[model samples]
Target: MAHTSPAAAPGAFVAASDVAALAAGAAVFGTGGGGAVHTSQVVAEQALQEHGPVPLVTVDDLGPDDLVMLMSGIGAPTVGIEMLSSRHQIDLLVREAQIAAGRPITTLMAAEIGGSNGVGPVGWAARLGLKLLDADGMGRAFPSAAMVSMNVAELPCDFAILSDVVGNVSVIKTIDLHWLERHARALTVASGSICLGAHYPMTAETARGAVVEGTVSAAIRVGHALLSAADPVQAVAAELNGAILLTGKITDLDRRTEDGFARGSVTIAGTGADRGRLQRLELQNENLVVLEDGEVLVSVPDNVTIIDAETGQAISTEMLRYGQRVAVLAWACDPIWRTPRGLELAGPAAFGYDLDYVPFKEINR
Candidate 1:
């Protein structure tokens, strides 16, 4: 098992020991999505153990001329859990992306700082001897590729490079994020619902203010808190400054993999002091909303995580099992996600839900 070390200075440096904590913390932000983290943890640990620690640099640390790429896996969490990805797959994708980038890729960043995507890039950076950016496109995971900070910031995606485990690769050039989502999903579905890719190539100058900053370090902090605390569940919530929305056992789950996403709803019957109450979670890959009696209690653009009540580990949508006791936690997302354009790109409306995003602070306070 990988062990975590003390927090690093300036910015976090992810070593082999940090993989376990990173995966655990990343899962919390995953919000029951972002593809499961177990396999990602293993791969990351292996890479770090072999290649030494990767320096996690902040956006400000980057030179204006430096090139950065977003490294991530695209597919349903259900499929990802079954089909383990190899370093060779990531190598192919990054190599192809580099060729398309037309310049040396100085840094690699997570497209989303949730689940496996958050952890995968650490290994990719280590293996490639590149720096890992401490920022990400999404502070939490979203099902669609278009729901990224760059899109909300109106930054253009020059191209996206994708590759499957079997060596098939494709480079898509499109300024439209939605079109990228559509085409990438098609290729991912064709490649057995899982593939590795790099996209959103931009100069450090362009990325400095366009991405969700410090998410990688935040994940490490949450993971470290979870590992050290006696009451991990409460500790994690406290660390994130989040609230426990519900504590219950999964009574029913309706889930399916379609169009490269795990779409579903889960019903939980509240236990303990909250007994006799029922809540439903509607999800498209990531937990989208929490509802009770048809009333929206919590919705997207805010972080909603369903975690194992006893262990504090987030239970991704694909891993939800009937009768498992869990706790639902809610926290405010980055302030950027609350802005008009951010909401337009990732709000309840973006996910096809008709509801206003209530700020977590307002709701909690």
Candidate 2:
């Protein structure tokens, strides 16, 4: 993930047209995870068009006494795309979470910065007249709910509200975030593979300390750079201080359902100076590992993203197709991700790989 100084207290607005740009930037931060936003973008654009602009507020805008809830989608992006949830689902989760707390919510924030979850709540903010905090729990998308930095900060995620497309709503009060993830995944599969949720209501003070600051604006600006720059791929690398890790065309893609999640791998036959060599990428809902000739190039925590070499569009793990040309990229995560606890919570080992976390700089060098 990329970082900049904290963004100023919010009061900005996202025009309906520019929401797509935010979605683009969010995909970059997704690091080949967070599910894709193709459907979410179309749906969000329509909502924004009907409702006008959505207001944005930074964590700094909130007082210590404010109440905030985390908003996100639970399920495979592919499934969520096919099984569209109701727009009213977000509002329902928010209301239910608040109802469980017996307090009204002052603002809504994303639990993770991602393709859909990062900017998804703007739709709700517009219709509900609630403040939308700009930061998120995970700077980039992580596979599990407990991977959020808020959990690292020891914030309790209780009274989660989940709803399916067919109007099945479940209000779960869990003392453990892992339980929240497990039960939520089960519910999501039962709901035909996508559920909208709101959880981890926290004080503004806790949110201020826990979230990855300036991520929303960062996504917006990255989106703008991609639109304006001649080489969108290079533009992203430059803007985020990332490295072009590899360039190639996908030769084969292997995907399957594992433990109720999408897990797979892909092989990219290198092109240009890298011709005759092959690169392999492992997946678990997100890009997990990058290997060239059996040597690790990049791994989880630090981003490992695949972008269309020509159009610069991101290809999510579930969307990788054979014969599509692409470029691989990597960059350092926020400083927090390098911490011992952060690694323990979200590092390579956290993803079930028998590898220690390597900083982007070291791995790339």
Cα-based TM-score, every candidate: 0.96, 0.95
**TM-score quality measure for candidate 1:** 0.96
Question: How many clashes in each candidate?
Answer: 0, 1
Model 2: clashing residue pairs?
A: 10-58
For model 1, what is the alpha-carbon lDDT of residue 210?
A: 87
Candidate 2 — which residues are off by over 4 angstroms?
A: 1-5, 8-10
Deviation (Å) of 238 in candidate 2: 0.8
Cα lDDT, all candidates: 0.88, 0.79
lDDT of 1 by residue, 250-293 (tens): 99999999999999899999999889999999989999999898
For candidate 1, the clash count comes to 0
